[model samples]
Target: MVAGIQLRIGILTQREIPSESEGSEERAKVHVSINPFPSLIPSELSKMSTEKERETHVYLAKLAEQAERYEEMVESMKQVAKLDVELTVEERNLLSVGYKNVIGARRASWRIMSSIEQKEESKGNEHNVKLIKGYRQKVEDELSKICSDILTIIDKHLIPSSGSGEATVFYYKMKGDYFRYLAEFKTDQDRKEAAEQSLKGYEAASATANTELPSTHPIRLGLALNFSVFYYEIMNSPERACHLAKQAFDEAISELDTLSEESYKDSTLIMQLLRDNLTLWTSDLPEDGGEDNPKAEESSKSAEAQEH
Candidate 1:
């Protein structure tokens, strides 16, 4: 319980609050009246006076007199209602820490009271580490096959008149091999070496397209989808990351015609990869990943349920 301490921002007492219905039950008693002076003005004085400026000046003066008292009443109300609050010592110390880590905060969110082993070490021992690696590998294997098929299709369809025909040939084996690597890839060096093999083809295509063509050329579309799949499928989703994969494949199809007719003939692998995981979505986010979906399970967080 707090004693009667007068904080600067403390809540107002009832005595300070005013009731307008009971105060001064009468009209204000002042009014001003005016009349023009008679027979005292020269006719020349009226000819030189600026009419609009004089009216504006007189209007401002009247407004200033009315506004002064209105400003005072507002200031009085602010003074009565404003407060300076006092937080508990714990709260004050926490405020000193400034910001909270917001990315993963939830009821399940917790701080490490003391640490020797990691938070998940008890669960993720050698056995579980191997399991996680296996799961991760399964994702990469599917993605590699998709990457390979796209490159093969690009080679078979080698577009004419775009001057990138040579690039299609050059990148053919490189891209196809990248597709195979999602399974055999072990470390950063292996991935880097494989990517370096394809870099020359990308650079050559960039140089060729820049000469007789503008940036909006259809070649960019093929490249963009290729990279999009690489970034999202290989990197983010893996085997389970095939969301919208077919749509991306289809959207990049017209550009495929710009390559050669044979470019897409052997593209069955790409089609197969795209169709692999069309059934899942964010609607299937894992329920047992240390949290419950409030929408999916409204009764999960009840205190009574936990006590049992």
Candidate 2:
């Protein structure tokens, strides 16, 4: 899937054999916290601002990393979109719908971002690009929901022995909020690739958990590790991305099944700690949103007008 996202057709859901009695629906009724984060932190937001400011750095780093991953994802999808025109009518239609928003949204979003980046020069109210922040936030929320749904299913794999009860529910929802946040990224082949790449990176970070460190909790490691893998798929890999994803999934799923109920422990509290730190800003971007954007738009429009 990583390589395919490299081509840009990311699959939102890969094939997974589900146990009929996994209790996936019940998991939804339960709630789990998510990592404390926003799509991105204001570059100027200082950690010294408050006692809670310290953890802000880590969250920003993670969110920045995720943003970069999505930028790469956009490139991969563009590649596939370029090829879509040659596809059959039905296939082209499907492909077009998948990229419909992202294709335009990225450009629109970039306009806002680039303008904001030049904040010193653009003092005009409409020229301030931050106004678009709300739309991006909406997109992020939608993505989080998608990720939450899938993770719920995947979380069943985290429970030790699948004992029919609330513990199973907690395991499923331990990081439920993550789904919506993760899903916020580009969700096609590109997303799959992104997830796969991220998974590998996290897995590499967690190598010591299983054997070398008996005190470490493998399930927790597995969850963090697996979340990154899902990012790999966003890179636009095809179905084959699953192979790269399988290792992490296996570790997580296996840990859920084999570990005895008595053996379960909060081996690593990192996930929970991070999960509670979500500090999203539903607030507006500064006024003066991207007025300077008109010049570029006008120039492009004139060029298109001439070409037409």
Candidate 3:
């Protein structure tokens, strides 16, 4: 005699069968269907190989950068660095330096924006303040993480290799920017320390650029402009600011004059910004002390008006 049998099935669950009937002593048979959704669970999904994870993060980072979501890009790149442990020393150093730049810029942007937000709050701009609060909070949280990660990358990767000239210059420049922003948004002690670091970084970049880059290099002019700002705004040293700005302004004007209008088009913004800085710093100098450059000042004002 044959015994009755029962079977049960459920989605993504094991099949169940009733035991054989006692009198007949018949055997029970059970079979499981293939899992239609194999990667449903977190564990299964996370089983992606390390290389794949690194590639995914790298792709995400590129997308984030294109979207101008710099903090997200930086974080994703950091993940790529963490997972790409098998990369060559040069590759790892390059990746770490690039990661540091993104993190530094993100942190600096947050610090600058937060400072502006505080100013807005002080001015009783409640509506704008409310609109930016969520964004400000998000950036603040990311900044805390970025600060720690930047130091780790520098200490572990950059310092070990001593970096190439270009990489080292970029590293110090970004480091200066990070500290400068930190000074502006944080405590007085940070201000002092950050000023010191900013000055040191700019000076190092300047020294490196003298050997590694041309006198007319855009990087050189940019470094000077930044250094001038650090002196004028952060250190409250107008004399030093004027000195650096004047040097940068002269170099930029000479460079600008040499380029064709078409070639100059690419550098218009940088030129305009350099002129603006020169005007700003010179105007702040003691009347007799500042070198008067009426032409440059007028040009900068015209550029400003056109931009508006």
Candidate 4:
């Protein structure tokens, strides 16, 4: 999601940001000319005092988003989050964007390595299997750290400081998303723990959405989108996934007229996503069985074993 801000002029500044990897001295110069939002002028940022550090970090985070320097963006947002103040919707979006991009690549890599490792093991290629396992473990470790750190921010700072239900729902949804990320690669006890935490987080968000948000709200719709995904992907419950997605989509469709112009695009976009997932999953559903279906059970068991 882009930080929705408008600006008229560019600010030229040099920043020394650390590399994504630990112990790296790499830095990049941020050309504010590329900033999507020019509403905040350079002079204003320059004249801000120490008390305005939050704004400065927020501005830098936006710049990093424009630069595709997600690590810096994540770092800057972490500082903003640590401030223990309620986050604006724009700031929350930037925070999610930063961590999502930073962790997304690693998740993709881990999945690829998992696939390759299975092939190597099946062929009895011990050497290649060992190497793939090692690299995959490193990726898993990084994913674990990222998820844990973000969860800490959500549980300790964001949730408590959230003065509005909108903010509460957003924070809980984010918590669920990161925990589901952990369940993607974690195994055994770790997988079980992540899955349970994910469910609790999504459940909390859903409960809040039921009373605190309108059906057509983007945050509510987004929560439905991801919560259904958790059921389908992590829990191996296509039926539940489809049910959740369809219910959310239908409810939102019924309330389409209530959607605000500001969130019309976002809410509609998520509704489309929900409908798409429902279509795909419903087509794959079993004819006359529930979670106890033998095929579903076998598939879930096989996937569980693969994580080990």
**TM-score per model over all chains:** 0.27, 0.22, 0.56, 0.79
Which ten-residue region of model 2 has the weakest summed lDDT? Answer: 299-308
Best-fitting candidate, scored by TM-score? 4
lDDT string for model 4 (164-250, tens) is 998888889888889999997888998999999999999999999999999998888888888988888888787887788889989
Candidate 1: Cα lDDT at 253: 56
Q: Per-residue lDDT for 1-308 in model 3, tens only?
A: 44454445544344444455754555556566554456566556455566678777777766775787766766776675555254433344435445555555665567567777888899999988887787877776666566656756654655444546665665566566556555544557756876777677778778897688644555555566667666666666666767776776676676665665653543455556667866666655666765433322211211110110
lDDT of each: 0.34, 0.34, 0.59, 0.80
- Model 4 — which ten-residue stretch has the worst lDDT? 299-308
Model 4 has how many clashing residue pairs? 4
Order of the predicted models by TM-score, top scorer first: 4, 3, 1, 2
* Candidate 1 per-residue lDDT over residues 1-308, each given as its tens digit: 32233223222322122234546333333233222333435454353243334334334433533564323332222221121122222222121111111111211221121121233456557665565555555544544544444344344432221134433332332342343233224358766555554544444543553453332233333332343334232343322223344454464454554554443433433443334333322343344553322233222121100000
lDDT at 306, model 1: 6
* Stretches of model 2 off by over 4 angstroms after superposition: 1-183, 186-204, 210-221, 228-232, 238-241, 248-258, 263-308
Better of 1 and 2 by TM-score: 1
Give the number of the best model, judged by lDDT. 4
Assess candidate 1 and give its lDDT.
0.34
User: Could you tally the backbone clashes for each prediction?
Assistant: 11, 62, 0, 4
Could you tell me the TM-score of candidate 3? 0.56
